[model samples]
Target: MAQNPERRAALVDAAIDVLAREGARGLTFRAVDTQAGVPTGTASNYFANREDLLDQAGRRVYTRLAPDPASVAHALETPPSRELVRHFMHDIVRRVTADRTGYLALLELRLEATRRPDLRRTLTARLQPEYEESIRFHLAAGLPGDRSTVSVLYFAMLGLIVEHLTVPEVIAADPIEALIDAIVDRVVPRE
Candidate 1:
């Protein structure tokens, strides 16, 4: 029989809470069960395995990082010029500060991907959209429009994520601050 909806959500929420509360190593069925107020058996029934559980957590993470309608509206209404990209960076900084757990787990997943090839596949799927969207935004701004350029931006964002997750300094590089400045300086508008 399928688990109750409330019960199922409880479990998923619990998984996120557990990851956030206890770090990746502390997330387990037993812990999630207790946190969710479900039986251990119930957790097993729902998830069936650890990877399945982590995948769920990853999806939750993806949703949090995703741009919302309001954010999207802002992006469209205001061009993703250097200044607008600075606002996007502020949002990223706020998220990293507000939800330390998600940021840490995100980096942890990246680190784990080095050893687990399958995890790399999973993360890449979630990452591609962000990459495409960001690259397309810059492309619209008359930035470089090429496959390799997009790949560089994608990996550069990943690198920045890791750096901030580990260091999380009070003052950090402004996202797109330098990148945008360089773009403005180098690329004269060609009409």
Candidate 2:
């Protein structure tokens, strides 16, 4: 295994781009190597196998997309209100739209997971924490609704994000901000 954490992270980042750009079939170590502009077999030295690479890519996607803690903390310090929730949803949309490739890659992983139980398990393990953390954040924010509400909001936002990112034509007719406001209105408890 590579002792250089930076090198390993770079390989993982490259793997994410390959997976997103080429899909699973094209996500070879060689592909990652090319993407990273490193010598051939550089990815192999860091990753044990395809599953390992996929796992790292999946994990990397989340880490890359995670919200800045400072921002989250600032928001948390503010009074918890439906308005705050709406602001949060807007931020979500902004972030997702900004990094369409990363989200698209994550969508690819979701499809790949269906065909491969091992990959599914790997992704589930890597992604389940997102849900847990979301719940924790909601609780800390004193946001209304039980876990189920958070779950609903999560899935709804995910659906909107998926559609917006993948098929702009499907929903481009309507303003996304309006749509997000609507979602937040329905999901978050009324102040």
TM-score of 1: 0.71
* Model 1 lDDT tens row, 1-191: 76687777678777877876676678789999998886667788888687888887788776666656687566658644545544554566566656766767676566666767877899898777777877676667544335555465456545555566666463265544454344333432322
Model 2 error, position 60 (Å): 0.8
Model 1: lowest-lDDT 10 consecutive positions: 182-191
Which pairs clash (backbone N, Cα, C closer than 3 Å) in model 2?
none
Q: Write the per-residue lDDT of candidate 2 for residues 70-102, one digit (tens) a residue.
A: 988888787888888888888888887777778
List the candidates' TM-scores in order. 0.71, 0.93
Q: Which stretches of candidate 2 lie over 4 Å from their true place?
A: none
- Cα RMSD (Å) per model? 4.2, 1.5
> Which candidate should be chosen as best, given lDDT against the real structure?
2
Backbone clash tally (model 1): 0
Model 2 lDDT on a 0 to 1 scale: 0.86
